[model samples]
Target chain A: MSVDARIARGGVLVLWAIFFGVLWETGASARYLGSRTQWIVPFGTVVLALAALVYAYGYLRARRGGPALTLREASGLFALLVPLAAVLLVPHAALGSFAASRKGNGLHFLSAGQSAPSKPSDASFLDIRMAEGDTAFAAQAGIKPGLRVHLLGFVSGSSDVPRGTVEIARFYIACCVADAQPVGVPVDAGRTFAKDTWLDVTGSLERRGRRFVVKGERIVAAKEPSQPYLSFRT
Target chain B: MERAGVAAPTVPSFLRLRRAWETGVVSETVFGRLLGGFVLLVVVASALRLGHGPAAQTFLLVFTSIVIEALPFILVGALASAAIAVFLPERALDSLARLPLALQIPGAALSGVAFPVCECGSVPVARRLIARGVHPGAGIAFMLSSPVLNPIVLASTWVAYGGHARGAEMVAGRASLGLVAACAAGLAIGRRTRASDLLRARPGERAEAHDHEQGDRATAFSTHLVSDFLFMGKFIVLGAGLSALVQASVPESALSTLGGAPVMSSLALMLVAFVLSLCSEADAFIAASFTSFSSGAQLAFLVFGPIADLKLSVLYGATFRRWFLLRLLAVTVPLIVIGTLIFEAVT
Candidate 1:
């Protein structure tokens, strides 16, 4: 498939522009791409339009018997498109598994004084605290016991806690995933839960040596929150 | 003659043995050579009384992650070059070259802001531009600046350093210095080297060859891209594995000790950057990890890396002639050092 060099180039530019526009609109905030506020979308759109103009030029030139798309030409276009498609797929795959896996493991721990509605009798609460030497929670002791505290975090991979008892775990991100640290407090809730479950728990925090155990609370498993991760205070 | 023929007929086993060695099917030499280095490493590790199990596990993890991640990206770069070879217009670059020198350098640099191509991808493209009549100086400038000046790099830097005043200041300082250095080197190279002296077009081409040369270049570009990708892929993996291994094997105390000495700390971080060959987008995170290093030293790491690191040097050497690359390094390295010194002086 022999394409006019001009046409192939134009097509590539157009495709790239559309991809960049979509990325920008969707809040893809990479430095080279655009900011999170969708400013790049219009810029990308303009590039795409210009590319269309160039493609039109190539098309007109070709119509005068300029050039035909050869097998090699088509393959090259396909090769370029395949990567573009794969790039598009990355966010979907990342969000799907990452969001689901981090569902309920208390990924976010609200500081002390955050209010929570009353909990149902059957469920128990766990007050999660950073381990000693961890600077993430040093400034604020999150959610004290006996106070109605609301917690949002994901369920981490399960761990066996002291014979026949299992505890759900979640990692809190103070920044990017590189700085993520796991926090696990014992949950006396009767049922075992799957890993990465996003949940909201209402309970009282019990302090246990840098960790807060939430006792007697309500657990509500739900969709992962928009902000799946958190950053450490600068 | 009859006696000699009879004797040879009875030696089938010997013939088989000879054939096996010739084909490397049964050569103990080859097997021994393959395992010799690994065995030596094991022996050394055992003698050191280190925890071999954890060390081995860490090495394996690092090796796989580095190699696997780098392979696809290098391939992407190679393919992009091939596409450029096959499809880009012949006179397109000439028209670009007609622009003023001042405009050309920044134009080339800004071109990358939109493309989002990594450092590996820039080498062949730069080569192609030079081949197509873009000034060698401008081409080199683009190659150096594109990796760091692009939107993705800027955004990542902002993201990584946004929270702190020091981080923000560092990014701004590096950007200012890096751009100035790239432009200065480019203009210097542009003025010094004749275009014909710097690059050789594809073989079987005339001084003013047109159609046939284009066709040959297209094929050569594809070949170059594929071969370059495969070759660099191995090294990228090796570098990454070595970095991961070092991270796992050497304790942080080693870095801390070096960190205590100002000059030693700067050189050590620079060495780390060279060894890691990390993508510019990711280097900031690694730099930040060295919380022990002073800001001036960290600035050196960021500046020296994008210009003269291992993988990029290899790419530059491969794409441009060794003489040209050496000259480029001579100019770039000292400039970076001066930039670093100036940055330190000011901040």
Candidate 2:
């Protein structure tokens, strides 16, 4: 092969390895990779490797019987590959950062009037000391237990025992919508609404022995809030 | 002659010392392409990384789960295309071409149920089928339906919607409508054009010549695989980077602009689909994220994305021609719009 062709072929191989290697590494830490690191590391490595390989391959091939790749040709190939490779790598990097930032944060609170009820006030504060099984009310353990706090969520399901009582639910998303977990707050509204109906209620944090429950009055039906689901807030 | 201290040219030194640095090394094309890629990378990376609080994190996680897991699978698809070029029996494809369109359409749609693979995986398979002599229309139809109707996508959509009635309604509605649209487009284009017109394959004799020269099937397969990897490596990187940039640059609020108006929403969602080019397996979750939009609009997002999108456009451009892609986009966009409308009316 001509030096140019040989260099191009070698450049292609090195570029392939670098791109795949970065992809593999990014894939491995995709769930936890920081956004900056994800984009820069994977794509940067691929670009640098490609440049070096093309240059070296061209020179070596020219020295041997192989065809030489001109600087123009090498650079042209790099230009094409770099952006294309970047396109692929960027998402992984962006997602990695997104995942990290979203780790424990609940879903975007879509309530018009009330902020998502959090113990620490700021949604960014993740309660690491809190036990996994603990409910939101459980976080209020030592505080005056019966303090009335406004709560809002969607009705997940209803209970038949208390005439027309229902359980209102919301999901907290830690990252994407998939990892959302439905969290319920029991409501004793006199009438029943359909499942998945959005509602707002004035409720007091109640402890039925060790169990935490929301005992509320006047559950009112409302329009579906944007992002009605609850996501995890880390 | 025997001069004292005369040194011979050593092969290793000669190899090492060869002046490789030529002037005018970087051309405008190379510089431009690399710079464009770098800019895109930086923009996307910053968008993903610099955001504060929960929203940023949610975006990141969603991006990762949906986009990252999809890369290897796509690479496999590209690699598979290369492999088919290397080793698969070309004659077997003739049987597929001879099958009636009636059998072919449904058969292609149902084929998705057999595999959990996503749209990216389908690309290579479709290409291989085309190379093997399947009608371009049939192969295209299979590509469209395979991702949406696949078992994994169905199951995921079902899980997201929370049961049989809703899930069935969503899947059946989207699947049937998408199938009709894709098949219609394929048939329309297929009638006027020959399969050879779509993608110019190497002459059969040349392929056969390469096949004979190789010592054995294994060696040929390996060679083809390596070349295939090299051929597709750049595109994979490009596709991934473009997806990231779209994810980062476009805000979720941008979706809200199209809310309530089904037509506008459909168009906007289609644009998003084009830009995001998300893997079909996980597009459901992203679609669900567009909670503000109606089911019809969400359905359009899912249907349009798998069939035609930026990444797919690039891939198609790489394989086919600009004229073909432009024609494809013209057909596919209207079909998706009509499908979305039908879904809205029925559901």
Candidate 3:
């Protein structure tokens, strides 16, 4: 490849760093990195930008005359950019049923020091999904039994649909999309919604046997959130 | 070849302009046009196709995540490799290499504390270390241990598994197992191997070694860093794509029951490690999420991954003889299996 082409490749990498940095800065990176790891994208942007500058400078100043690029070399460079461009071009998306199912996403076990509750309180499906375990999920996370539950998620693949229940589920990530685990609220919507449709459900968390289920007041179609996964910490 | 005497068919004006731009002094002009057009086409096509299905969407999201996560670490690795190339004192390196293999192997593995480079970085440095006259054993051990034993990887493991009852145990298991495998592999594979036999110079490096020798230090460092980053980044992108494909297509149900079988579970996770090629710094989190698997299985994933994977195999192959991988794997896999079982029994 030409010296200019080599330098341009460096510039392209720098741009990618900037592209992902903007995503992280603007909250788009939450779809992939969890709360704890989101910092990497921005840092990568800075480091890569600097590296690109150094590279461009060094290559420009070097006095070596190299041979012309072979077809294989040019093609190899193009191949590296294919997936990168594909990822950045498409709008950001959340982990869906297919990804969730692939990771075997499910309710996580409780961490230490989070105790079981003897009584339910005011909470929503979001609270339960983020909670430590089934016990913590059942106890209203400050939510009373018949309050508005604002919930947003796509229908999960493993969610059992019946005459009146809607399982609005979202994946919870610990690091990145690969480890995203599905956490859903089984909502009694009193009607049926097709799977994989993003929805905004206004419901109330209610105790049912050993689980906390949502009894919906109203369910409306909603757009996919800019950041879809619930991070482990937040 | 076309008859030289035959006048080349009169090329179209536009085609001539394109060819001229491609070979012209300002070659970047053609590259910019082609890149911009390609990006536009891809953007439009991906946007149209992204929402087509959950599977496609899932694949994209996972693929992007893997790419974003691995790129930075690889860049860091490149930088570290550059430091070794540009800044490491030849005499110091020689002194270290002169130590007996018994001390050199473990010492190299332990030196990861001083340089926290990741696996991507480790391969290039290992190749350099061997090429620069370090004992092949020491270089191999350093390569094996640096990615796993480094504080970055260890800390990530602590964070990932910290909440579990066996978190500390798992971390310990991963470190000890990794160190053992690395040192053992170093001694086992590189003990008497010729340095020339242990490494193959990179095509660019072999060609440019004479030029770089005359080049200024700053230019050399920057050049090495950039070239190493670009070179390693190629395999990373491909590896990330392959890993995402595996994550999207593999059925989770298949491994659900295998977690109970310690032997099978360890092997299953080893396979996952080989395929995913997840960076060491981030892999602990993924391994931690495998809740059904025993600690032993998880430990195996952590231990085996940084040392060997599809990407590392390809990356290592570029710098070493073809036998390097088979040799590394032969000694490393059994140790991981046995280590996992021991860890299971102890924990």
Predicted model with the maximum DockQ: 3
By TM-score, how accurate is candidate 2? Answer: 0.58
Candidate 1 interface RMSD, angstroms, 1 decimal: 15.3
Which 10 consecutive positions of candidate 2 chain B have the poorest summed lDDT? B200-209
Q: What TM-score would each prediction reach against the true structure?
A: 0.51, 0.58, 0.85
How much is the lDDT of residue B346 in candidate 1? 78
Q: Rate the local accuracy (lDDT) of all candidates.
A: 0.51, 0.54, 0.72
lDDT (tens digit, per residue) of candidate 1 on B149-231: 77776665555554356656777866776687678778877666766676643322221133225445433443344334433
Chain A accuracy of model 3 expressed as TM-score: 0.78
A98: Cα error in model 1, Å: 28
lDDT of 3 at B224: 78
lDDT of 1 at B196: 69
Q: Per-residue lDDT of B160-220 in model 2, one digit per residue for the tens?
A: 4544576677777667776776677667665456666876442122433364365445434
lDDT digits (tens) for residues A1-234 of candidate 2: 223334454555565456547554645433333222244345435544544454454344332243244553454346445433433543332222232222212211211011233553222111211222345423543223465656666665534223345666544442233233344545566667776566778765544443234466656777655334333321
Give the interface RMSD of candidate 2: 10.4
Which stretches of candidate 2 lie above 4 Å from their native place? A1-28, A31-234, B1-68, B200-215
- The runs of at least 3 residues in candidate 1 whose Cα sits more than 4 Å from the true structure, single-residue gaps closed, are A1-234, B1-52, B188-191, B194-228, B234-265, B323-329, B344-347
Model 3 bad stretches (over 4 Å): A1-5, A24-26, A107-149, A160-164, B1-51, B162-165, B256-260
DockQ of each: 0.04, 0.09, 0.35
